[model samples]
Target: MGRRSVLPALCLLLLLAWGQPGAAQAAPADPPRAPSTVYAASPALAPGAITVHPYGQLQQSDSLDDYDTSPAASIADPLEPWNRFWFHFNDIFYLYVAKPAYNAWVFVTPHQLRSGLKNFFSNALFPMRFVNNILQFRFLEAGVEFGRFFINTTTTLGFADVAKGKKTIVPVDPTGEDFGQTLGRWGIGHGFYVVWPFIGPSSVRDSVGRVGDCFTDPFFYVYPWELATSSELALRFNALGDVLPLYEDLNSAAVDPYIAMREAYINFRNSQVKH
Candidate 1:
């Protein structure tokens, strides 16, 4: 594949590795985990904020659309001009494109099949969890991740997760780690906030770290190229079903969706590193 063709696969891997809460669940995506105390209030009105008013006119009017032609008023996200532009791009894409596609996928696909896809995708990315655990020197956690993969892969072909059982001898840790957290654990700073097109919230450190995590994704190997391509697509489209609704809820509740997502994401990433 050419460079352009490879981009989608990498984005897909990062999306999977980016694993939000309730990502594995069937859709009508769960309510967002309650925002942390700090994020419970609205951010100050500022340029480079990622706002999505429910009103269509505001999205098209001077309030939001000016980001394309104007510089962000603050250094909080000096990249805000471009970031706001992409934020709008992603918002429109999700509403008109991704959300509709997700609805159609849900309409035709049985819940059981979707659930299997979820399990299989999670199983396929075992290396992300395994390697990150090792990076953090959590050898025992790494071992549990290792055993969980073999048991799930061999006995049930990843359709069932026996490791999650209440009485199971080997307990699995569902709090999967990623390259971003690994970097943070090693004292890397979150350089600045970024709103990636289609991919959503991230920072400079996490963005670079995301690319690294993609190399650990099993979908890039194991299966034939064509099979690998289709598998990754299926996994992400399925994930979209569980992600878009949460986006809708967050946007509706926030005074400015952009700042809400930015603050929440930063707080969440910091919490992940501290843990």
Candidate 2:
């Protein structure tokens, strides 16, 4: 059936699924103490540092393998001169531009404004991801899909690319799982932590997946000149506000933000796989 025809049915199914007796139960909270095995091997760390690194060397090795396998990393191999140039550019944009914007969003905005903006952005993307979530059978995919679709559609006119049949553009469905989740389903464990300049920290697999996602984003579909600059800024501001809580939680809890982020990424990715 066509998407329009199928959407209503999918929404009904989701509503029913969510109503299941146990569906409302919250997920187990992250353990207060790190796993004992982690502490046993790294005796130098204080008690609080135990959960900081879950898989240890094994995780790091696995991340390296994913980095080696990721097509984006291959194309932008750190050793290549052109790639290095681009990486530097990415760093400048992220550190000087995006990071500052994100910081402003967190610290400068009034709480009510931040909350309202986040809701506004999230509400805009809800319809698209809600439909896609059913199609892909992954709710997290639906959630990320919502964020991506909102960003592209509002800021860059990305939805037009999908309408035009640009297969390179990421699909708008939330049900579609990310590459790292796909890797995990294939039984590959998450490995070491690496942070990219603009994109933030992600394993080799997730980093590659983000590139694939960017291609599908609506931003590529819009002529940069055609999109309103103010609208774009608003979207970024809203996006940062929405994720500020997650950033704060990560910083407050972990001794190493990189490792904490990696674990959170993996945990979120794994949740997608199950859905």
Question: Which one wins on TM-score?
Answer: 1
Estimate, for each residue in 187-257, the C-alpha lDDT of model 1 and write its tens digit.
77777667887678788888888777767877665345667666677787896765676678666644566
Best by lDDT: 1
Cα lDDT over the full model 1: 0.62
TM-score of each: 0.73, 0.42
User: After superposition on all CA atoms, how large is the RMSD of candidate 1?
Assistant: 10.2
Worst 10 residues of 1 by lDDT: 20-29
Each prediction's whole-model lDDT (CA): 0.62, 0.39
Q: lDDT tens digits, residues 122-213, model 2? A: 44434433553443455554555555565656754552222223242333322333334444444544443345544454555555444433
The Cα error of candidate 1 at residue 201, in Å, is: 1.0
Per candidate, the number of residue pairs that clash is: 1, 8
